[model samples]
Target: MKKPLKFPDFKDEDKAADWLDKTDFSDHLEPSDLKKINLPNLKSTKRLISLRVEESLVEKAKQKAVKLHIPYQTLMRQVLHRGLEAI
Candidate 1:
């Protein structure tokens, strides 16, 4: 039987972060790791379109993105894609 993996427990957030920073796994990743990962391709080949939203809407989108810990542009793209699919 294989022994269960045991992970070290850190007492504090700083200790945990420091442990992660000190650990090196360069050998585990290949050249492909250095390349940008592409998202699953959407069949739509339509040209990109830009839309102007109200200042308040933009601020709200930014705030939501920040709260969710994601880039505002990424959140906007997700919202747009879902909206298009719904229509």
Candidate 2:
């Protein structure tokens, strides 16, 4: 197994930025060391269309979206995308 990356505790944002500024990410992210992670809310280069659904359903989704800290539309898209992939 590869060693986990260790980062130092910074005094503030500037110190953290300074360290990151000098560091070479290639040294850390070699192709063999790379791992895939799902990036939620990644904006797609696509046009939007008008989509209509039941208001009650939208309200319920909005309530859940608020707890997850994402817009209802983004949450819906994520759910729909996953559903599509499951087929």
Candidate 3:
């Protein structure tokens, strides 16, 4: 079996940050640089509840996200939005 590669330890935050900044990301923008879209604000909304799901189900969703190269949270949000629209 092939062993996973290990990264070298860095002593300073600046050095680590600099290395990451130089890494190629295929022309992706930093989070702060992205254009913001105006969505309807839900600040006045209340009664939001959080639910826990089985670890296996969460892992399955994460695996699907990895396969599609998108964030798992984004996939979950889209699914929730579609379900609400159907109701």
Candidate 4:
């Protein structure tokens, strides 16, 4: 089996993203090395911002958050995280 390259230890997310921009995942990752990460206690350091979002969209997000049993802000963060991963 081909040895998987270890992902570099980054000081912060920006550095990790910079590395990702320069590296191809196929060269560094293997299916067997993939593992589920659950950060139930993780707290993100967030910056306060005023964002203009559609009222209907906000209501839909609140409904989804209620269904998922998470805070609406937490649900929004999850969605944003997934969107960032797609880039």
How do the predictions measure up, each by TM-score?
0.44, 0.49, 0.41, 0.50
Whole-model lDDT for model 2 versus the true structure?
0.72
lDDT of each: 0.66, 0.72, 0.61, 0.75
Q: What digit string (tens of lDDT, one per residue) describes model 1 on residues 4-74?
A: 32336655544554566776645445545454633333234445778889999999999999999999987
lDDT per residue, candidate 2, 11-84, as tens digits? 55545655778787764565677667543433444458888899998999999999999999878876886699
| Global local distance difference test of model 4 | 0.75
Candidate 4 displacement at residue 3 in angstroms: 21
Model 3 lDDT per residue over 13-66, tens place: 434545666665435555455455442322332245787989897888899999
Residue 25 lDDT, candidate 2, scale 0-100: 72
Candidate 1: clashing residue pairs, number: 0
Q: After superposing candidate 3 on the true structure, give the runs of residues whose Cα lies further than 4 Å from its correct spot.
A: 1-49
TM-score of 3: 0.41
Could you tell me the lDDT of residue 52 within candidate 1? 87
Q: Point to the candidate with the largest lDDT.
A: 4
RMSD of each: 14.2, 13.6, 17.0, 7.2
Model 1 stretches with alpha carbons more than 4 Å out = 1-49
- The model with the greatest TM-score is 4
